[model samples]
Target: MATYIISSFRNHNKHVTYTSLISTSVNHTQILEEFHKFQYMQTKVFVVHGSPSISSRLFSMAKDVGMMSEGYTWIVTSKTTNFLKFMDSKAIESMQGAVGFKSYFPKSSKFHGLKHFMGLKEVDYDGMWAYDAVYALAMAVERLQTKKHVTKLALLDHILRTTFRGLGGEFKFVNERTLLRPIEVKNVIGKGDKRVGFSIVNGEFVKKMGKTNSSTNNGLEHIVFPGGHTSILNHRRLQVNGKKMRILVPVFGGFKNILQMVVDPKTNLSNVSGFCGDVFNVAFNVLNHKVDIEFVPYLFEEGRTFNDLIDKVYYKEFDAAVGDITITSNRSRYVDFTLPYSDMGVGTLVRNADKSIWIFLSPLNADLWFTSAGFFLFLGFVIWVIEHRTNEEFQGSTTQQIGTTLWFAFSTLVYAHREKLESNLSRFVVTVWVFVVLVLTSSYTATLSSLLTVQQIALKGGSVQFQGISPVKAAVYNNVKLNEDVLVELRSADDYAKALRNGRVGAIIDEILYIKSVLALYSRHEFSLVATSSTTNGFGFVFQKGSTLAKDISTQIAKLREDGTLKALEDKWLERQSSIMSNDFPAVSPNILNLYGLRGLFLISGVSMAFALLVSMVYLAREKCQGRSKMEMLRRVSKICPTPSTCTR
Candidate 1:
């Protein structure tokens, strides 16, 4: 902008009487002291850059230079308007009646915009410029994407040719330079600049002021100057200096990266880093001003809250507080808040229950398992005892006899035993044993079904409860219907893990996002998410009630959101949030097969084998005592165990 103005001056009509370069503050002072040298020159209007010192010097000698009078006019560039906020009273005094340029931005309607989302009322010039630049670049890329061997040069060429009606106006390049929109001329009035004129690329000011010579001086009427004087000064100017800014931010937990207090260990001076701080830096940069910001952590010296933080701004205790402070109606009543940069509402988090190693064994109760084994042996022994004396097929050595007895008993469970029962007693026992086996199998299936379905779990009986928070509300939000009776008050966050691990709680539920962060941080540990709840309002920066910075910062945040920077920021941290939620465990019947479940049946089988062995020994001993031949022994056995029909007769 300065080069453009200087070039125009150099190419002016060649009969120039003189040229002046008041470059430095010292030089400006010299020119003001020696104003008489150029006082009578034909060129009365001085087209200069925005220099506070130069403007200060001009104001200091307004009478000598006839600066406030109608004959002399200063046409300055945009740099002067940027320092309007930081300009001292004296600097502003020097700026009286001075017409300065600022990039002009036309406004338009938007939807779900900064104002609606973050609470920003409007977008600034830089925001519009950024919007146009992004839009143009996006169009260029879209056009180039279809081509082969797309290169940066081609992209740049396409961008220069791109035309879009952006927020700032028509975005186009001319003379190999991006075309600048009309620049606004803020007339230096009493302590403020009012939009009195505007200059387009044609370098002609469109006058809006009602005073005279609006045609010559950028084709505008007249402008008001400092000291409430119109085109005239009282020959009085005050000297002033600018000061550094002090910014207040809160030091609290819960919202980590959004805002955090980081004090230098060596200097012990407070500093800050986070999304809030980063966005603030960007906002100021866009404002085209360098502010020496001294970040002061709001030292509450006691437990503080969003309300307390807002109150500090209201009371003028600090310039502004920056953090993930929520902007709510209650908070708004006390202090002003910028537009919200994030979504509204809160959610829940729950610790994933650790899996049990022996969970596979839970299907059947221990008694049922043991009893099934007992029945196995009982059925085995019954058949062996009933058939041993009557049939040769049951006749075997002690070990073989025992093996047969156990095999037949267990085999009956699957209806796979090959040997037929010779005696009616054995057949009756077999039939009953088969029925028992069917009952046991059916019972196991039903028990497993109930366990896996969990259709009737007691919420309160096993749920991890939160202390200092309404368990009923938490449960309701997390989709667990429970009253106080079902809620277990926790001592701390750790208690949730402990109670869940120890089987003291059925489910653990809490703030969902926080739990996700914790789970991500502790990804090595086993955890699970039960559910996330209804939306809770979002967090935002706090400010003194009605603070413009709140609006300004919120506006920048909104821009960031519009450009998808907010989504990127979320993705930045969210990507680090890994999940350890595992569903690899196979679902086995709670009545899973185990040694303990079958121990009772095996024990009964051992005892039955022993009883059979004793009977065999008794029979052998009796035969020996009888001192009879094989035929005699056979005759005695036949009499005791005849055919079923014979026995019935």
Candidate 2:
């Protein structure tokens, strides 16, 4: 029995066949050593058998030995009916019988002979080897690595590439469809007597062990698959002769908050089962259905930047790319892009600042404050006039009246002094108040007014409005600060317009229609138009440049758009955000825009006025301390103060 088992493991069969039966006391090492010799000779048929060893362990040992020896291999398991009875009593005595061995395989005597062998089921072996064989054939054909079966390697190569479903696995060349079959696991069971056993429990092969699968007495579990790991090996057909082609796509980027890098698993772009993966799958389906081509992703490292990856693709190392890439003319000139898969625009990502929408409304921003200030200013001026008008208006000792009037004017400007002085005002003085209010108000308005000699240049303080364009441009302009890429740059509309006028920038970008209109108004003599490429695509496919695939893909893209599929995706990703008032808005209050605009205005005004008053007081005090006449101080004041003129808006 030992000699028979050894012969079985030593390539005794001309055809590749494996049997599970093995005899007790067979030399396992000798069997492996002999098998290795057969493998060196490129012998494809060999059996690996070990008596008293579990089938799994024997197979594993055989695989390792065969791989090292460069040969195709098969494995056979031992069948033992009365395992306890077969336990060598002499060997047990030699080992002092203090130990016992529990085999990982079933101890049923019915599981014997060639029929009960581990790999006797051809299905198991076929599945296990199909993937590897297919991949080997494809690689060999691609590299032209074949023996001279024919006069030239071309005939074999053609055969290899064209042969589909030649192996156990399902295969398709034209459609790029493969047998996506799952591996089945079978559990062996014993029959009534010794010489008969069958696989009883049928289950699918699982990569992971679940909590629900309980332990056996030996605390060991077996993984059984119809086709072992080898079944799903890399089997792909090149199919060069057909019109159909395969395209490679590259992906990159990191979405931190949206999807976790590690925890959520799917958030990582490189994850084959992630969101990006789903996107690739969809793109593949679209491309494959339309043109009978296959889309394979050159999946590699994924991060926030893809410059290095683009370098690879641009060099023709990869076919194309689809992930997060900022589209620009420079990239377009080098590589072709389908319309934009999605929009890439800037948005306000407010952190801690107040974000109220009400602040955006202009009038409500200062209606209350202006009303109160004006009311008090009117009251205070009237009261002051009444108190001193009895003696006569502007007729008091000029020095004292001037100082009092200055204080009244400054106080009214700073605070609501009018509300405090209403009690002192008389009816006749109120008539004079109307003229005073008109004269003072005219000098301060920021209009096309020539009323004030100072000609106040009201620098537009942070109210971004480019009449015809959308807010997205403003947000992008504020965020993007270009460094040194010469072929492309992002600039604000104002900067772009300036550049265009100055003949600095090649082109000014806006909405296509908007830019066209602006360019129409300009003379042809100023700028020569070269080319116009879409920088940000709303909906497009990406493909290899100059390839007819792009045109075909464009048709499909249009189809998807017309059917509202594109719109649905847009709504799903972009427009699906909750209302602005939702919790995701922000923790801070929302009045910051108005507050920012108002606070800046008031701060500048207050500081300027305060400094002017300080300078005036200094000049007066200096004249007095230096014993100069009051006339000198008056001269300085007249030099500093401006004569009022026509008001502007």
Q: Tell me the tens digit of each residue's lDDT in model 2 across 379-443.
A: 44434544554444434686876666556654544343342233222333333343433433432
TM-scores of all predicted structures: 0.37, 0.30
Worst-scoring 10-residue span by lDDT in model 1: 233-242
Candidate 1 — which residues are off by over 4 angstroms? 1-244, 252-259, 265-268, 274-288, 299-303, 354-513, 528-530, 533-535, 578-649
Model 1: lDDT to the true structure: 0.58
* Top candidate when judged by TM-score against the true structure: 1
lDDT of 1 at 541: 67
Tens digits of per-residue lDDT for model 1 on 161-214? 888777666677887674857777788777877887776665566764223334
How much lDDT does each candidate structure score?
A: 0.58, 0.37
Q: What's the true lDDT of residue 476 in model 2?
A: 35
Report how far off residue 408 is in candidate 2 (Å): 12
- The per-prediction tally of clashing pairs is 31, 26
